[model samples]
Target: MRKSAAPFLLALALPLAALAQAPVQYSLAFPNAVHHEARITVVFAEVPAAGPLQVRMARSSPGRYALHEFAKNVYDVQATDSKGQPLTVTRPDSYGWDVSGHDGTVRFTYTLFGDRTDGTYAGIDQRHAHLNMPATLAYARGLEQRPAEVKFELPTDWQVATQLRPDANGTYYAPHLQYLMDSPTSLGAQQRRTWQTLGRTIEMSVLHEGTAAELDAYVEQSKKVVQEAAAIFGGLPEYDFGRYTFVANYLPQTSSDGMEHRNSTSLTSNRPLRGAGALDNLGTVAHEFFHSWNVERIRPRDLEPFDFERANMSNSLWFAEGFTQYYGELLLRRAGIYTDEQYCQEALNGLVGAMLNSPGAARFSPVQMSQQAPFVDAAAAIDPNNRGNTYLSYYYIGGANALALDLELRQNHKTTLDAYMRAVWQQHGQTQRTYAPANPYTLTDLQRILGEVSKDTAFAGRFFRQHLLGHELPKFDQLLAPAGLLVRRAKAGQASLVARLSFNPADSTATVGSTLVGSPLYQAGLDREDVVRKIDGQRLTSAKALPELLAAHKPGDVLTVEYRTRGGIRTAPVTLAEDPTLEVVTYETARRPVTRAMKKFRAEWLSGKAKSFYPKPQPEDKDVSG
Candidate 1:
């Protein structure tokens, strides 16, 4: 049985009176920003003078599922009262401080050190300060419903790019704690562009050393992506304030990342917006922007009212993130970024190949894989793990499933995934949401929607049971046939162990990385760290030797193998198997017949959807100020 959404709604139902209380105010100074440090102060007014007021940094940030323990970078903690007198501070837990003798008010201060520029962490330097709010700010526990206001004491000539509503005197406001934490800020010398579309404003603010012409060119391409994504949902989600921003930092110092927020997405990349890197960077933009509707609004029940104190777990990311992943690339094709079926076919090949061959996908369902985000989604650890054997990314699994469902719907139901997504948006996403999503969806809700969309409840039930909950892969070979695409073995006659080999030139030995569970090498008792000395009594001289040896033989051939392991040297007979890898190619490329129906299906599925709409006139570049 699933948990009811009633309790979650009740907990989030805030009274209008609580919002009038004095907000938690914060001031961020960067005297030591050149050295990667920020001095932050927060004041909690109207403290009840109860036992003690607790103030703490967040353990996790929005859109990130792992426990980052943001408090690790905080130091030199101190507290004071309204009159500048020091207060008694006690460490009640590792994440926060408790202050007494406050007289109904407590001012907390801390020095934070950060040097990484990405979506989940704070990166501060002389050039810029990239702040993900949860990584940079502290909040009082009981004041979650009160208003929040912050002012940035930025360096000279530096400006801010964020989704936070601008108030007078360089201050920004959020309705409550959740809204504040969901806003990310990029402070630097930024180049800005804005355009009006579908009765809303869309802006792209980029902080890069590139020329103005380059930024303009990037924005032109980004606009196509934005329009295509919006067309999928019928229109853009009513963004907070009727404006959406893309807060981007693309510099050599910035790490490659993209995070989705309510009104904006934090995009950071080290790649320059030129040549191949430009197209590569646009892929991230396509993915994150689609999240504006899929995840940011059509939210998951598990991730609603996100907890800042621990990891947020969700079972529906397969659809939330996965369907978005499928569309991220598909939309790129629809926007003319990818001009050929070959480029698009590569994406399908990779998705199908991994899901079909990976042991992890064979063992776990999409729901189980979605739950592994806490350990795999940008999570950090030192020890080695067997994730290769046990886990497949929800992105790939979900994307593959999306491809199947879309084709199935088109062929059998006389509809498309686009129509189903539009249904979901109208039902779950297009609600009247303010500080947070008012109508996050659950698994049960999705099944019902699928039933309604297809007009066949039995098909929806069977699809969910066999493909989502059951450990079974969709039949891609049959699904792709309708699109004039063929899924065939990449190397039909080749023999492979399917295990990675690291060769040592000098010693003429190859150390096995991780042997596939049931491959010939594994059946012969060879595993990771085992050294292969000779195959069929031929000493290995170079990395190419193994491939050359395998080329001479076909599947079902048996050969003697010699290898060294921790136990001792041994010899065994191994039975080779055909390479199970699959690849997708157009029928024309494969010299196969393509029917008229196939041609029509491919065109209808991939052609641009937003081209019929009249182009919106571009506005002049706006100079953004903090």
Candidate 2:
């Protein structure tokens, strides 16, 4: 049976004077069985005098990547007035409904059969049902800023869980309509677990057929991630603490990704825990959780008072997603999940990938990437050379830039990004703080904020304009040299042991039919058709043993590799050049002062560690032109 609600705060009473102007509440009852119809009832408080009130599904939800015309699932919609007179409804857009000529309190009812992929509603079979709101339900236009109360009615054998605050009589009150729309609620025969941290409660709801052991492990790890993240961010916000819900649907032939929302985020992955271990999961969780501070609350002007029907364009995704990405990994490192080497490797890997793949890196600016995200799918198959050239991802390149600036700031001020972010929390994250519609913090505003914390206006201004807005790639080699790591090509004739390989496998036998261009093997003249027979004289029978063989040699080492070529057996003696293309920045204890300063400077100015979030304020009586 569905769990009963515990006693909680009472719902905020609507102002009596505004009752006539308020819209009626809507209730939706979603059944647990897949393909079973779900019913929705909307009661209008008062009908309009001229035209009937209209209701429509959202074109898209915040943090989601795709356009979900949510109204597609709706069926059998009916409307009636207070006098029991049937009202007429017509479909206007692919996801909208237009009600005709009603002037009294009207009740609208509809049934929906859910089949969703990216947001809100999901159905695989009779065994599981997932529903994420905002993407599933329609909100009243112009009333999106008002407070709301929600209730869920699930099957007797099913459970309903959400991060929204609970109210008296089992109903929940969203802090505001935006929160009501952003918090996704899931219902089904799901396994649920709860944890508390920093005076806030965390919940994990997995809607899979996995065993209890698996479910419990997933929940425990999720809690650990939350705790670790809170430690780095200086704890969660006490005023509006909310839960984090994980709706794991173990579907075959699907990939893993997540969408962040206010208070909660919905994640879809093939296996709840896979790749990069617990720390990797922790970083993922941290990235999403940090959004509560960065993107969800401290938003750009275009995103605030969001327009749900269209794309909200702004040249600030680099700050929103990119900085959040940097923090995600940084928080993990600070929490001790990743060693210095692992963290360096991850950062270098991302930078190398972006540099090698982004063809438009020199042409299209970060601003363009942020503004064009609504149209491009970075993961889709396209021309390889031009894939990222004209289509930069604010998440990747912007993140690298942010990380560079963050590290630079840390070195210069002898502090960390934690300090700057704390300032942002104090200034913009307060519940009482309301950002202006168009006056949201620009690049200058960010620099001012950083100046307040560090008193380094010059450094902040240079970093923001030259690296972030001007599109100058940092001198990464110099940045890591101070840490005792040198960036150089492996000596010729010295074949270093293989550090890693990027490949896409099609079969279980670990046969590499294709390899990523610029990968070690690809640079070593290992063609796409070459069947690997041996490495360093060891028979290359399985993919697992290749790593051990590669680890035997240092940066400068020669290897005799044998593989099957189309013509015949082929032998190649390849010298590893420190994998120069594979940029790895590390720390060294001893270095000359000049080299150290260069490294420090790179870390401070070029590593994307600039302290400013926006551009600097101009001088009085000086006219600036872009």
TM-score of candidate 2 to 2 decimals: 0.72
Give the TM-score comparing model 1 with the true structure, all chains together.
0.94
Q: What is the lDDT of residue 392 in candidate 2?
A: 62
The lDDT, on a scale of 0 to 1, for candidate 1 is 0.87
Compose the digit string of candidate 1's lDDT tens values, residues 512-615.
Answer: 88777778888878888998999989998888999999989999899898999898999889888898888888898899999999999998898778765435
Off by over 4 Å in 2: 1-24, 117-125, 145-147, 209-221, 239-255, 274-280, 377-385, 433-440, 486-626
Candidate 2, after superposition: displacement of residue 322 in Å? 0.9
The whole-model lDDT of each prediction reads 0.87, 0.58
In angstroms, the error of model 2 at 347 is 4.2
TM-score of each: 0.94, 0.72
